[model samples]
Each structure stands twice: as C-alpha cells, then as structure tokens.
Target chain A: MRIAAQAVLYAAFVAVIGYFSTSPAYVHLAPGEAVVKLSLSHAGERKEPCRTRSEAELAKLAPNMRSPTVCTRERVPVRIVVAIDGTTIFDVVAQPTGLAKDGASTVYRRLTVAAGRHRIRAELADAPGGRMTYSATTEVDLAPGRLLVIDFAPEAGGFVFRS
Target chain B: MRAALAASLDACEAAFDRAFGQAGNPWRHLGSLAFLLVVVTTATGIVVYAVYDTSVGGAYRSVRAMSAGPPAGLALARSVHRYASDALVLTMIAHLAREWLRGHAAGFRWFSWLSGVPLVALVYASGIGGYWLPFDRLAQLSLTATTEWLDALPLFGEPLARNFVSPASVPDRLLSLLVFLHIGIPLALLAFIGVHLLRLTRPRSFPPATIAAATCAALVVLALMHPARALAEADFGSEPMTVAFDWPYLFIHALQYRTSPQLLWAAAGAAGLVLAVLPWIERTPHAPAACVDLANCNGCGRCFADCPYAAITLVARSDGRHLPRQAEVDPRRCASCGICAGACPSSTPFRSGSDLATGIDLPQAPIRALRASLDRALETLAPRPAIVVFGCASGVEVASVREPGTAPIELVCIAMLPPSFVEYALRAGADGVMVSGCREGDCAYRLGHEILRARLEGSREPRLRARVSRARVRTFWGARADARSLSAAVAAFRRDLAASPRAAGPSMPPKRREALDA
Candidate 1:
C-alpha cells in the first residue's frame, strides 16, 4: 500500500513537471501586431566650434606637431523625439559614448502597434531650443510579426527606414 | 510561535515517516536528495552537450534537429537534461528551507550556514546559463533581458545590452562566450558545493536507493511525456512573438519586465542579506566543549572514529601510558553532544569509585553526572519491576513520558548514553531499559541515533556485553512532538517486562561489581 502511494505521488509530480515544462504559450505579440524598433547611433554637432589657431599660439608647440585648428572631441548631448502617428513614444537627451565623448550617441527602443500603415517621425536636435538638425517623416505598411527599423545615415543626414 | 512551527514540521515529517518509513523519508534527507538531483542534472547535461553546437547560427539548427523525433529517439538526453535542471532548483530551495526551519544553522553550524548563502544565486546562474545555450526565441529573451539587467551594475564598462541592440551588433563569438559561461558557472557551483559540505563529516552525496530511484524514474517519465523542444530561432530585428516559455528559469525575465529592474535588484539583494546574516542573528549559545582525558583513554581510537564533526583526532600519547596515541578534541569543531563519551570503551558505570570520566566527554553532561542521574532515578522507583528510560533532549521530551516506577534520564543526545548503561540499568534494579532519540535519519547531531543503535547491536565497538539479556532491552524513537507515541511505546515495553517475572531491588550484580573493583 505504501509503495502504491509513493508511485502515485511520483506520477502526479511527473505530470506537473511535464505539463508546465512548455504549456500555456506565452504571447510575445498580440494578433495583427508589428514592431518598429528605432535603432541608430549618431553624434551631435560639436559642443564648441573649432577655430583656426594664430601663429603666435602655434609657436608654443613642437615644430612637427602643430595643427591648423583646435576642436574639442566632446560632442553635444542630442535631444531625440520619436513619434508614431500623433503619439510621442520616445524622448531622450542621449549622451555620446566614451570618455572623450566623441563617440556616437545611440538609442534602441521598440514600439509595438497594430499591423498597418502609420506615420513615423523621428527628430534629433543638436543645437539649443529643440531645433531639428536631422529629421525624417515617412509612412510605412507593416505586416503582422514583421519588424521595421528607423536608423540614421550620417552621410545622408537623415533617418533611413528599413523593413 | 516557533514551537508551533517546529511541531507542525514534525507532524509533517511523521506523516512521511509513515508512508516511506524513516530511512527513506524525503523530508529527513532533503540535503542528500538535492545533491542527488545535482548529479542527475550534470549527467544528463553531459549527454546533451555532446551534440550541442556553440555557434549562434548552428545552435538553433542543432537543437531543432535534436527535437525532431519521439522523446526516446533523439530528444531523450535534451528533455532529461532540461527536466533535471529544473528539479535541481526545486530541491535546492527545499533543502534550504528545511535547514533554516529546524534552527540547524546556529552555533557550530554557522560556518556551513554562512557558506550556503551565495549558493542560491549560483544555482540560478547555472540554470539561466543553460537556457541561453539553446539559442531559441526563449533563449534570446533570456539572453537579452539578463544582459540588460546586468548592465544596471557598474562592473561592465560598455552596456552588455549593446551587444543585442541590433542584428549587426551581435557577433557570432557572443554564443561562444555564453557557452564558456555555462561551463565556468557549473564548475564554480561544484567548488562551492565542496565548501558547503566541508564542515560536515562523511556528508551524504545522495539519498538512499529508494528515493534516488523514484526521483530518477519520475524525471524520466516527465521527459518522455513532455519532450522538451526549442521555440523558433532567435533574431535580433524582431522579438519572439508568443513563445512557449519555460517558467522555472525564465520567470526572472518575466519579473524583470513586470517590475522594474531596480525593484528586482533590491528584492534579491535584501533576500541575500537576510540569509547571510541569519546565522549571527540566531547565534545559539555554546555548551562547554568535549575534553579528552589521557589517563582514561587507552588510545583505542573509538572516540576519534565516532566524533560526528571530525572534531576528535588521535594524537601521540603525552602521558606515561604505553599506548601509542591518545584522543584529542578540537574544541571549535566539537558540538558538545557527548557522543564521544559513549563511544569510549571505558565509559562503563561499574567503575563507580573512580573519577567516572571517559576518554572524551562533554563537560556539560559528563559521564559521572549521568551515572549519578541513573542511581537517583532508580531509587525513586519502588521495589517493583522498575524501568529506566533514556531519552534525547533534542528528540522526545522524556518528562512527558515519566510515570511512577519509571525513571527518565535525559542526555544531550541519544548516543551520549553508553550501551554499557543499558546493561547496567537491567542488572542494577531495572527490570528492562528503553532508549529513544530523534526519529531515524533525523538525528539533531546527524549521527547520534545511528551510532547508538550500532553500538547496542554489537556492530560497533564498546558494544553491550553479549551476556546482557537482549529481552530486557528495548529501543524507541520519536520527535519531541511524538510524546504520545513515545509514552505508548514505553507502556508496551513496561507491560512486556512485567509479564516476564523479574525481581527489582536497589541491588547490583555481585560478580560484575567484583570484576570492576579488581
């Protein structure tokens, strides 16, 4: 009788482990939903503008080591605002990477919405008063479970949408 | 409140003891059962890793291929590995709770208790690392959430999350490093396990055969029925959209997202701090440690062999005796349980005129005091068939079992009562002798009842003399909550002894008394 009880307990425990191992599927996304992950790294304009050095100041340096201009490696903190339709979903004043602060400012944020056509407007302000130095406004039709990304092209000086 | 809690735990243990019998009880052997689960995990893990691919692209491919067939076909090893790892977490937490609830983490046990604090995190880390190796959608969720969570701490200069921010950012070598972590963390787990068991003497590596077999069979059945499989492969641009999640290890990520990362960190930190400081908070006051007497010690080495904490060592003889070595007790490791006193061959009460000191003895509960207690207890019993009851203070409370014509002598632990005392009780006025301790496998000092039983059964040294009447001796066991059962057992033994006529008087066996005097 004891052996039977032990065996029944073993079976019950096994059933629990078996059912819960992979059941009640997790919903990472709702039906008819798509993801727009805004991922880009872009350094803002220099905090202080470069100026040409006078010969008198250059003379203080070693002869072979003199440069034409002096510019700070530190980049200005950039205020970014990304909107989907009319709703502002992401806003941050991103600091540049690295100790010298010359590295690119970056952001990776995901916005999940119902799959369809929608307006995505991303704006970055390098100067004061939220003035837009780089910006893009585009309409995209996304399939369910598809991922769309808004990235920055430094050379193009604007956001590039990819699906 | 604490007494109520301990009684509830004992009642639950008593229920299990009825079903499984004492030796095979799961609640009593939780530590060993957990260790056994660890072994099963490691064994099945080796089988799964044999076919696992470490590259990011190939990892999902390899796992999916393995999951293609019936459970017994190709997924056997993988399913078993996953289930065993999950079971390891369950057993480890149960072991921790059992020790903590029983107040087994104070005084001489502080070292073991303190060392085990970090093990909870280590076990989780090991399981989390296992989840990442599959490179499926669930693995991506685990890997990304973990990296982001760790980035909250200042140790890593670059955000670990940056590696998973985009498809181009995640390098193939990232999977390789994760595989390395999988190996390194479990090795650390093994090292910490060794440290955890260091203070214990002859620590049990596994549960008894019945439990081990039953647990293994259950894991196999679960694996065969469920047949663990990977979700769709991990991709950086898009996240997993409705995965079949393994909640055991992956629940951390769900929680990390539900409550903010800062809250989770605070909770985990608070829990760890409490566990680490609990031993000091409940520091039990120490009894005087056992001290060895070289004059009485014959270098027989029995006490050294019987010290449950490995506290006693055989040293070169310091006295004039011709014996090569004497027993020495390391006070720090000694728990003052007095089992060593019982293990001493010279612990015979017949040498009443002498100091009554044994080779090794607890200063708190010395042999001389015990002999005196026995003499006084028998005196209280009348001229009828008197009964002497020896009980462990940590086990059944003998005071509740005490009745007229019955003498109850409580010891620091059950094994502290020398087997010679049982024979001495029967010969010196008691019609029969009864001994009780913590229910089998639940010894407070871990080996008290086992060593005592061995001694009486003649399998161990300082055995009860063969001339001693076996019928006049009886042994019973119970938790402190089992006083009613203990009383019942004692009454039964009393009746059995009364049925067989035996005259009881305050008289000693003349021949044995003469032999000891000479």
Candidate 2:
C-alpha cells in the first residue's frame, strides 16, 4: 500500500510537469520569406577637424610636450538605410563601441522580405552631416527562404553582398 | 571553544537522525543527491540549448519565443532547468554543511572537502553563465554586476563593463563565450567530482534510484508551479527599477548593490581559504593503517574489495604459494576502520590457536586482541541468560552501560566485528547479542555502520548464518548523547530473553547442558 501511494505520487508529479512543458497548440507560418542581413565592421573614419596651436598656446606648453595640433577624440556615428525596389525598409544610427563612446561603430541586422527582390539600394553616412559616405546598388533575384548578406569592408572601400 | 561547537553540532545531528528514520533518508546522501540534481539540470539544459540563439540581437527574442511562443514544453523545460540549478546549489550547500557539522571536513577526509570548495565556485560560475544567456533585464543586471566585479582585478586592460554599456558595444561573440563557459565549467566540475571520489573504494556516484526520482519529481513540481519566464528586453539607457535574484547563486551579486565589490571578494576569498585549509587547522591523530599477514593471507581479495578507502591492493605472492596474490595496504589512504579484518575469512572467532590473527588487520587493535576481549566479556557474564553488548568506541561509550547480566565490549568501529562473533558468543552461553554503533549516516569511518548492517541483515558478503536465530539478536544505533536510550535498549533485550524459552534444554550437549541447567 505504501509502495502504491508512492507510485501514484510519482506518476502525478510526472504528469503535471509533462502537462506544463508541452504546448497543446502552436501556429506554423508559411515559409516563402527571405532575410537580408547587414553588418558593418567599422564605421567610416571620424570627420572632426584638427586645430593648429597658436603661438601663445605653444608658449605655455612644456618643452617635451609640444605637438602640432589637437583633434577631437569623439567618433562619428554610423547611419544606415536600406531600400528594396524603391521602398525604404530599414533606417537607424548605430553608436560607437567603447566606454568613452569614441571607438569604431559596428551594426548587424536582419530584415525579412518577400521573395524575389528586384533591386536593393543601401547607404551609410559616417560624418556629422547627413551625407552618404558609402553607397551600393544591385539587382538580384532572391529565392524562397534564402539569406542575403551585405557587409562593409574598409579595404574594398564599399559595401559587399553575398547570397 | 571549538570543542564545544563540535559537541553541539554532533548533538544537533543526532537529534535530526532520531526525528527522521535512517532508511531512504535524503539527508543521508546529500552529496550523491547533489550529483543527481546536476544530472537533472544538465539534461534540461540540453533541451533549452536546442532552441537557444547565440546571436546577441536574436538571443533575447529566441528565449522569449521559447518561453512564451510555440512548443509549450520548451517553457516548462526552461523553468525546470532554472529550478534544478537552484536545487543543485541548495543541495551542495547542505552537503557541505553536513560534512562540516559532523566534523568530516578535516584530517584524512580533507581531500573530499577541499575539492568541494572549488566545485562550489564552478557551480556558481556555471549558473550565472546560464542566467546571462537570455539577454533579459535580469541577465543584464547579472552581467553588469559580474563585469564590475571582474574589472576590480588588474588582469584586464579594459574594463569588461564597457561591453554591456550599449547594444552596439556588446558583440555576438560575447554570447558565444557565455555559452562556452556554461558548457565548459560543468565538464570541469564533472572532472573534479571524479577526483572527489577517487579515494573511496566504492563511491556512490548517484543516489539511490528512489531518491533520485523523488528529487526530479520535486524539481518538476517546482517548475510547474513557478515556471521561469524571460523578463523584458534589456534597455541600457534605462536604470533597472528592480532585479529578482535567485539567492542561492546570486546573493553575492545582491551584495554588490550595498557593499564594495572588493570587500565582497575579500570576504569570499578568505572564507574559501579557511575551508580549504581546514584539515590542517583541526589535525587529529588517526589510527595506523591495517597491515596484511601474508602467511595467513590466501589472496581472496575480499579485504581489497571491502576497504572503504581503497587502501588495500592485491599483489602477486613471492613465496611460490598456490594462491596467486596477497593483500597490501596504503597507509595514507586508509582510515584504519579495520573493516578489512572483518572481511577476512580467517577472522572467525572459533579459531582455537593461542595466538589468533587475521589475514589483514589493524596494528593498534588486531583481530586476536579483539577476539580475546570478546572471550573475556563472555566469560565474566553472570549465570543468568546474559546479553553481550557490542558498541563502537567512536559512538556511545560501552563502559557506561552497567547492566547486571550484560557484558559490554567496544571496538574501533562496530564494522570491525565479524558476523561469526555473534554466533560464537551465543554458543559460548550468551542468551542475546546487542550491537550498536554511531547514529545512522553518522559513522566516523564513513561506511562502517552501513557495511555492518548489511552483513547482519544477510544482504552483503559473509552474512550471519541462518542458524543464528534472528530473535536472539538486536541492533541499536545511538550517539554520545544516547547513553540512556542505549541502556534502555539493553534492559529491554534482557526482558525479551527472559520471556523466551531457554535453548539449553535437551538440544544441547550433556556437559554444556548441565553447566547451563545448574
């Protein structure tokens, strides 16, 4: 009788956990959508201007500490926009990665779109002004459930794409 | 002061044993139970890992989807994983506390205790890494506090807290590192567990099946009742209004809000150092390890198998004997419980030789001396139906049980008593044999009382013969504080013996029957 009671208790325990762990209902979505991923390794270089020291400013400096000029330590934020077939879908400004907020900026995003993209236009601005520092335009056909990637390479001096 | 504290702890442990019956008791096997819980946590963690997204941006969404979206079992599995981690910490603490309180944290037992200190740190690291995987508000708080703590050390050139300052600052690789640590530390913990059990002859890697099942069942019930869910997405710009802490593993993080992290680390480091060096702090002289008498040893390997500390090994005999091997003892590993002597077939008390010896025996208290003591105790008993009470020296003191017709004899541990001694005492005119040892699960030599009990119950090797009437024997477990109860047990045994029919009537030998009848 004791064994039977223990067995019943164990069975009840398993049942309750089993009931809570499994979903009785779920929604399954159709699978024809494609994803476009964009990644920026480093935002374009800073656009802050350097100022030359005046004669009086140089006179106050120590003999060993003299230098040409002083430049701003802040970095330009990277602003990016993505357009598919003349329709803009993604736009955001990504800040630099550091405790002082002066390091290089990086971005990674995934945008889901209907299959068979006609044309894709991407732009990025790393300066304080809203000027396109880099731009890429390409025409490509996207397959169902495919992933298209757009990444920036400083050495290449432009955006690169792979599908 | 230390002695007083130890005495009080022993008293408390004895009280606990009396309140809770020994058999199937979970507290008796906390270390094994903790190992079992780790297995449960790992099993559930593997399920959660299947749906985990390692990317920083998708990590939070994937977790939220798992707990709130489809595959309903996923959420429950996640909760089980969380609760089991908490349960594992709880059991590990209890196991540590029990060992400390019972005074098993020092001397030769120090290796097991010291190895466990690092295990606590590893479990904490693994648990916190699990929390960091979801990228929720709580995870963010945990990550921030952990980074702040890490930054206090001079090892890193850049403060790690910089990584979590903003979403852009945190990289997907950071999440990968967390996953790697969560998996890697536990594997390291598994290796440490192997080292922890290396000294023991037969370590119980897992608890009894029923206890394991019960622990899992309890974890499941907890998971169902209080399912774990991911909090809101971490917003770096916003200050955390509140953070729920799992106290078992996150109490140190909670301390970060009130005290300096350096102070917390200092206190924790000091405590860990003390725990690691406890064996040296409370050094006590242990009995000399057992020695093997190769002349009497036939190399049965029984002593080697029965050694609780794995101190004995069988080596090839050099004397050109028919038997292939002989027993050898490792002094450092042996606790000198003399259980090997009990397992020796030559340990039977029926030997008539003037100098009695066993194949393997403790030098301090050899089998011949023990047999001599037993014979003397039986010879001194009164003419009435007498009872021979066997007690452990480490347990209740035998000298205190002053029953008129009962003769008390003490051994290094009751486990050193060969089963045939009970029959020998009975045939030598004792009416009853009463054996006692340290309270259940509180054996001074780890498994002494357990092995003794199994032998008496006929389940283990060298069991008591069936001819020995079960009714003529009784076993009682008690501690130093249990003297009065032990006395009462002896008195009750006397009454039972008086009530039963005398065995010295017609079935006995004529001369021996005359001596008893007179």
Q: Which candidate achieves the best lDDT against the true structure?
A: 1
- lDDT tens digits, residues A1-163, model 1? 9998788877876676666667667777778998877667777888888999999999998988799899988888777888989899889787877789887776666667889898989898876455888888999898787778877786876788876
Candidate 1 Cα errors over 4 Å, as ranges = A32-75, A97-116, A125-132, A142-148, A153-160, B1-6, B165-168, B294-300, B313-332, B502-518
Query: In model 1 chain B, where is the ten-residue run with the lowest total lDDT?
Result: B503-512
Model 2 per-residue lDDT tens digits across residues B9-81: 6665554444444555566788898898788889989998998999888889999998885434988888878
**DockQ values per model:** 0.48, 0.03
TM-score of each: 0.90, 0.73
lDDT score for residue B417 of model 2? 91
User: What value does DockQ give for candidate 2?
Assistant: 0.03
Which prediction has the highest DockQ against the true structure?
Answer: 1
Error of 2 at B119 (Å): 0.5
The alpha-carbon deviation from the true structure for residue B314 of candidate 1, after best TM-score superposition, in angstroms, is 4.6
Candidate 1, B364-400: lDDT as tens digits: 7889899888877865775456788899999889988
Superposed on all Cα atoms, model 2 deviates from the true structure by an RMSD in Å of 12.9
